[model samples]
Target chain A: MRIAFGGNQAGFWWYMAAGAVLLLAFAGIGLFRGAVPIDEGDVLAVLARHLLPGERAADPSVDTIVWSLRAPRVVVAAMVGGCLALAGAQMQGLFRNPLASPGIVGTSTGAAAGAVFALTFGLAGTFLLAAPLFAVAGALLSLLIVTRIATRDGYTPVTTLLLAGVALNALLAAFNSWLIARSWEQYEAARRIAYWMMGGVTDRGWVHVGMVLPGMVIGCAIAVWFARDLDLLLEGEEVAASLGVDIEKTKRAVLWSAAILTGSAVAVSGVVGFVGLVVPHLVRLLLGPVHRRLLPAAFLTGAWFVVGADLLARTLVAPEEVFLGVVTAFVGAPFFLFLLVRHESEVAVSR
Target chain B: MMETRGSARRAPRLELVDGGVERRGRWLLRDVDLVIEPAMLTSVVGPNGAGKSTLLRLLSGTWRLTEGKALLGGFDLSALPRRQAARRVAYVPQTVRPTFEFTVREFVTLGRYPHESRLFGTRSADRGWIDRCLDDTDVLALAERRVTTLSGGELQRVLMARCLATEAEVLLLDEPTSNLDLAHGLDLLGLARRLACEGRSVVLVLHDLNAAARFADRVAVLDGGALIAEGPPAEVLNPDLLRRVFRVEAVPLEGSTAPVFDFEPLR
Candidate 1:
C-alpha cells in the first residue's frame, strides 16, 4: 500500500515553492562561505554583474571565486541531485517498490565502474565527455543484462528483479575489484579509481556540468513523458497491459531512462549515496505517488537536498570538507529509518 | 448524455472455441467452449483449484491460449492488440491491493487510457464519461477520497467504476464480492446485473452457489480443469451435478425466481 497521507493535503503546493527558495539559499550560501569570506550581497552582486550585463563587482577576485570556482559545483550538484532523484522515482514506479533505488539495483555502481574504467584506461584524458559516455553505456548494458535475467515469458516479476539486481551488484563489485588490482601498479590510476569510489565533486569544473546536463534534461523529459504509463505500471503488469500500456515497451523505456539518469549522475558525482534512494521516497511521502507530480517534485527536492548538504559539508567542519556521500548517508539514513518505522507502525495501526 | 451513448453501446459477441491455457505440459484449463452474449450475467462456479481464474484470464485475452481460439466479433481475441481489445473487454482481478494514493476520480480516469494516446492530452476531455461511470457504480460521492482510505466494499465499487470507464462490452470480474458482507455482496451482484441489463456481457467468477443461482441468467460449472456443465442456472446447477462435482447435496428454496440452492456436504 501507499504511504499514508501525512495529514498535509496541501503539501505539494508549498513543497515546490519551498524547494526553489531553499535551493537558491543553499547555493547562495555556498557561493559566499568558502575560502574567502565574501558577503551574500557580494555574491549576488557578482551574479547580477555577470547575468544582467551590469558593472563589474567591486572585487574581481570574488567574481572569479564565485563564477569560476563555486558556481560549477552548485550547478553540477543540482543536476546530479535532480537526476538521481528522478531515477529513484522512476525505479520505484517501475519496480513497484518504495525502496528500489538505482543504487540498490547496482546501476549507479555500474556507472561509477564505467567512469573508473575510462579514467584508469586513460580514456577520460583522451576525450572530455568520455567518462559520462562510458558510464551511460555501462548503465544501459547492465540494465539490459538485469532485465534479461529477471524476465520470463515477457514478464519481469519484482522479487526476481530485485534478486537479479543484487547478483549484478556483486558481480560488478568483483569486476571493479579486479580492475583496481590491475591498476594498482600505476599509482595515478589507482587513485583515480579510488576517487570515483569516494563519490564527490570537490575540484569539479564546467566540463563536469556539461557532462551531466543531457542526462538530466533527456532523462527527465523521457521519464515525464512516460509518467502516466509509470502510474499504470505501479498497479501491476496485467493492469498496465489492460489499460493500453505496452508492458514490455514501458518497462524497457523506464529502465533505460533510470539507467541514463543514474549513469550520468554517477559519472560526475561518483556514488553519491542516498540522494537517489531517499529523496524521491521522502518526496512521495510528502506529496502523493502520482508520477507526473512526483517525478518533478522529487527532482527539486533532491536538488536542494544535495546543494544544502554540500553547504553543510563545507561549513560543518571548516578547513577540511566532508565527503558528499558521507554527509548524505549520515543525514539521510536516520531519517529514512524514521520514515520506515513510522510507516510500518502506521500500517500496523491501520490494520 | 448517458442516453445517447446507451443506444450505441451494444456489447460484441465473445466466444471461446475449445480455448484454454496450458503450462509445462499441464493444462490449467482445457477445451472450454462457451458463448457469452450481451445483456446477460454469466456466473462461473467451480470448486477451488478448478481453474475459474484461468478461464477468466483466457476470456479476457490475458493468458495466452494453448488450445483453440477465443473470438470477439468473429475475430481471434488473442490476435488483437491489447489496446483495441481493451476497448471491447475489461477484467477485474481477484485481489486489488490498493498501492497508491490516487483519488477515486483519478483512479477511474486511468480506465480511459485506451482511448487516449498523446504526450500532453487534454486532462478534462473524458470528464463526462468518468463522472457517469462514478454515478453508475454509486461511488460518485466518494470520488474525492483516496482509494487507499476506502473500505473494501467502497473500493470494490470504485473498481467497478474504473472498469465502467473503459466502456468495454465484456467485463470479467474474478470473485468481486469475496470479502464483502452479505448486503454488499448482494449489492455488488445486483450492480453486475445492471451492467448486463445495460447491454454489456458481465461474467462473474463466484464461489457462492446460491448467489449464482439467484442472480445469473446463465451459469457454467467447472471441475477437474474442464467445463462440466453449462446453461441456465436451473439446468446447470442441478442437485445431481452439485453432488457429483462439489460432493454437496443441494435443495431449492420454496419460492424464488431462480433455484436458491442450499448446499450441504454429502455424508
Candidate 2:
C-alpha cells in the first residue's frame, strides 16, 4: 500500500543513482572497448588533455581513436537513445497506453523516409542542416496526420492512432524503398540508403551530436513542463479538462515536442527501434508512472540501454560490427513480446 | 450535522438559461433552464440515458453549450478562462480509472494544480489543504494506499477528497454512489448535504429516488432531457409524477421521516 516513487523520496533517489551509475559504466565500456583496443587510462588521459589543452596522453593514436572516433559515436548514440526514450514516454502519456511509442506510431520511420529522400536526391549536398530539417518536417507532418485521423470530438482514441500509425508506417517504408530503387544507378546513394534503413551510428561525428543534443534538451524541457497535465490526462480527457488542463494545447505541445525529438534521433541514427518502447517501460516499472520522475529516469535508462547495445554490436562479432537497429531488435523484440503477454495476462486476471 | 464555516460571503450561482447540447446533428438535451443556488443540495433524478450526465458535463464546462449559455457567477461559462472556471467549480465524474498507480495522497494533490504556479513541484502551503480534505472525507487512513488497490467505496471517498481539495464553491458530482453499497451510499449523501450546509452548492445526479428525496434540499425530475418537475422533495416525490417521468408505480411507505418510494413496474 505504500507509495512507490512519489512518496518514497529516498528510494527514488537511489533508483536515479543506479541508473546514473549504469549509464556511466556503459559509456566507459563504449569509449574503452571498441574496434581499436584503447586502455582506460589512455582514454582518460586523452579526455584530460582535451580538457586542459596542454596535458598529453600516452599515445597520439589512442587520443584520435578515443576523441574523434569513439567519443562522438558514443555521445550521438546516447543522445539518440535518450531522445527516443523521452519521446516514447511522452507518447505513452498522451495516448494513456503503455503500448504507444514513437516507433510504433510511425514517427521514426517517417523521419527516416525524409532523411533518405534528402540523401538520395542530393538535397543535403554539403549541408549538414538539410537532412535534419527534412526529417523534422517529415516527422511533424506524419504526427499531424496520425493525430488528425485519430482525433474525434476533441479526443484521440488510442486504437485509432495505432491503426493510423501502422498504415502510415507501411506507406512511408514503401516510399523509402521506391526512392532507394530509383537511385540504384548511383551506387553511393544506394549504399547510403541501405545503411540508413538498417540504422547505425558508424562514423558519426560532432556534427551529428550538435544536431541532436539541442533538440533533446528542448524536447525534455517541454515534456517536464507538461508533466502534471500528463498525469491528469491519464485519468481521462474530461477529468483533465475539469482540472484546468487545456487538453488541446497540451496535446499539440506534447505531440510536436515528441516529433522533434524523434526526428532528431532518426536524423542521427536511422530508426533505432525498441529504445523508445522498452526504456520508458523499464523506467515506469522501476519508478511508478509519475512523469516528473519517469521522464528523467527514462532518459538516463534509454541512454544506457543504447550505449550498452551499441557496445555489444561493436564487440559481439569481433571484426564485423552488427547494425544498431538489428541489435536493438534482437534484444527488444523478445522484451516487447514478454510485455505484451504480461499485459494480456494482467488484463485477464483483472477481468 | 450541517455546519457553516468561515465568514459570511456570497456563494457563486450557476445558471443554465435554455441550455441545450447537440452532437452530430442529434439533440441530446434541449431547452433546459435551471438555477443552482448556494447552501443547497440539488439532486437531479432521471431514467437511464436521460442526459443527466450531459447536464453535469455542461455545468463543468467539459461539454460545449450548443444552443444556450451557462453562466457562473454572472460570467459566461464558455467565456471564462479554464483556470478561472476550475477555481469556481469542481466536478467528480461517475468513475475514473487511472492508467498509473498513484497513491491516494498523490492523486488528491492534483486538485491544487490550478492554484500552484510551478509545473512540477507543489507549494508547501498546499499540503495542509490536501491533508484537511483527506480528513474531511475520512480517507486520511488510505492516504498512502495506491488508488488502484482501493475498493470501490474507498476509491469513491478518495475521489471526493480530491474534489474537496479543489476548494471550489460549487461541487458537481455524477452518480457518486453508483458503485457504493447502501451504507456507503447513505454516508456519501450525508456528506453532500453537510457540504451544502457549509455554503457550497452541491449538485448530484442520482439514480435512487429515495436517497435523493432524503438528502436533497431540492429535487429536479428530468425525462427525455427535459425538466418535468422541480420542487422540494415533499412535493416532488408523488406517485403520479413518478409514473409520468420514470414510468413506474411508486408506493410511498408511511411512518418514515421522509417519503421513501418503492417502485414497481407500471401496469
Candidate 3:
C-alpha cells in the first residue's frame, strides 16, 4: 500500500511534467512551422533578435503565423481540451460510472441543438453572448433533466443513466437536424454549423480563451474540492452515507460543475468528442483513483492532449484543416476499444 | 479508556415508539420500550423476518421510527445528525459488495471521515488510528489488496477494521459471519467478544443460535418485531420458548457453553 501511494504520487508528477513538455513542444512546432517551414535557426534568430526588416535575417511571415494564428489556436485548444476532460472526470465521479461521457449523456447534443438554433436564427449576430449563453442553458437543462430522471427514486442506476443519455442525445440530434433543414436560406450557416459541430480551433482567438477561462476555473475548482467526496461516493450510497458523504448535496454540486465545464468547452470550440471520455480513464490507468491527485493531473494532461491534437488537426491535412473531433475519435476509439477488451474482467467485477 | 468513560456516562440506549410500522400492514414492532447497556455484547436473534434487523437499523439510526423516538447516547436518533450517530455507532450491513475496486486501506480510511477535520487532510492521529484498526482486525497485511478480490472472511475482517476506524464504542453488525467458514465465523465471534471485553458495546444479529449462545453476553429474541425474550443465553435458549417461537423440538444439552440443539427426527 505504501509503495502504491508513493508510486501514485510519482506517476502524477510524471504526467504533469510530460504534459508540460508536450505543450511546450507543440507550441514550438506551431511557432516554427510555416509556408516556408522556418527551422530552429530561424526561430532562434527571431527570438534572440527582433529580426526587423533591416535588423536580422528571419522570416516575418513565420513570426506572424506562429505568434498570431497558431498561438491563439493552441491556447484555445488547450483550454477546451482541459475543460472537456475535467468535465468528463467530474461526470464519471458524479454518476459513479466510468462509461459516462458528456457527449453520450446529451450535454454536447443539447449544446449543439442550442448553437444550431442560434446560428439559424441569427442570434449570434443579434447578441454578443447569445450563442454561448443559449448553449450553456441548453446543456444545463438537458443535464438537469437527465439527473432528475435518473435519480427519481433517490439513486441512479448505471444502465438507466446510460440509456437516458442515449435517448436524450438522439432526441436532441433530431431537433438539431430539423433546425438545419428549416434554415435552408442560411446555407452558409448550415455549413458553418456542421464545421463547428465537427470541432476545430481554426481562427480561434484570445476571446475564446477569455470566454471559457472562468467556467473552466470554477468548474475545475469545484471538481477538485469535492474530489474526496467523490472517492467516498465510488464505494456506493450506503457506504458513502456511512462515511459522512451527503450524497444529495454532492450530487447537485458535481452535476452543476460538470455542466459548466462541458458547456463552456462546447460553446467555445464546438463539440469536441471523446476528450472527456478518454482522458479521465487514461489518468486513472496511470495514477490511482484518488481525485486529489487525479483531477489536477487529468486537467494538465487534458490540456496537453487537446493542444497536441489541435496541432495534428491543423498540420495533418495541410491547407484542408481536418476536424479536431474526428482526429480525437479516430485515435481515441481504438484506444477505448482496447481498454474495453483488456478491462473486461474489471468491468465485470464492478458490475 | 475514553470510550469506557463515554459509555459509562452515556444513558442506556432506548427505543420509544407511538407507532412504528413495518413493510406489511402487520405491526411487526409496536410501541416498544427497551434500554441497552453500554460496553456489552447484545445479540438479536429470531425467526426469519422477525424485525431483528429493523430494530438494529432503528438503534443504529439508519432508519427512523415512524411515531416514536429512538435514542442513542442520549440524543434522538432522528434528530441527531448522521455524522454524530456514526461517530458513536458504527454500522455493518450484512452483505458488503463494493461496485469499484477499493483497496482495503482506502475502505478503512472512510471510517475516519467523521473524525477528520473537514478543512485539514487526515491528521496524524487519524492515520495512526486507521493503522491500528487494520492491525487489530488482522487486515494490515492485505491493506494494498482490492476489497473486491478479498474472500468473504477477509472482507469481513476489512469491514471490521473499517468499523474500528470509526472509533465508535457501539458496533452494530447485521449477520457479519453468515457467509463465512467455521474458522472465520468463530474468529469474528471471538473478535466481537474481545471488543466487548475491551468495554466496547457490540450489538450483532446472528442467525446461528449456537454462535449467539457461544459469544453474546445477552441474547434478545424478537418475534414478529417485538422483543419476546431478552436475557442470558441460558435463560433465553429454553426448549419451551424455542418450540413456541421456532416451531421446532429443540433438545438443549447441558454443560456446554454453546447451546447444542438435538431435534427429534420426524417418525
True contacts kept of each: 0.55, 0.65, 0.24
Please write out the lDDT profile of model 3 over residues A132-177, one tens digit for every residue.
Answer: 7778878888888887788865766545767888899999999988
State the lDDT of candidate 1 residue by residue for A1-351, as single tens digits. Answer: 344443243666677888999999888777778967778898888888878875664588888888888999888888888999999999998888888887656787688778778988988788867877888778877888888898998877767878888999999988888888998988987887787787777777888898888887888878988888888887888877776777888877888888889988998888888888899898887677777679988999989999988877777888788888889999999999998898899899888
lDDT of 2: 0.84
Clashes of 2: 0
TM-score of every model versus the real structure: 0.93, 0.94, 0.88
Q: What is the lDDT of residue A178 in candidate 3?
A: 91
Q: Each prediction's Cα lDDT score? A: 0.84, 0.84, 0.77
Assess candidate 1 and give its TM-score to the true structure: 0.93
lDDT for position A58 in model 2: 60
Model 2 lDDT per residue over A33-130, tens place: 88777677888888888877674646878877998898899899889889999999998988887778866677888898899889899877777677
Residue-level error in angstroms, candidate 2, position A326: 1.4
Best by lDDT: 2
| Interface RMSD values for all candidates | 2.8, 2.2, 3.5
How does chain B score by TM in each prediction? Answer: 0.94, 0.95, 0.90
lDDT of 3 by residue, B110-211 (tens): 888777665575788787788888888888889878776788889988888888888777888999999899998888888888788877788899988878
TM-score of chain A of 2: 0.91
Error of 2 at A141 (Å): 2.2
Best-performing candidate as measured by DockQ? 2
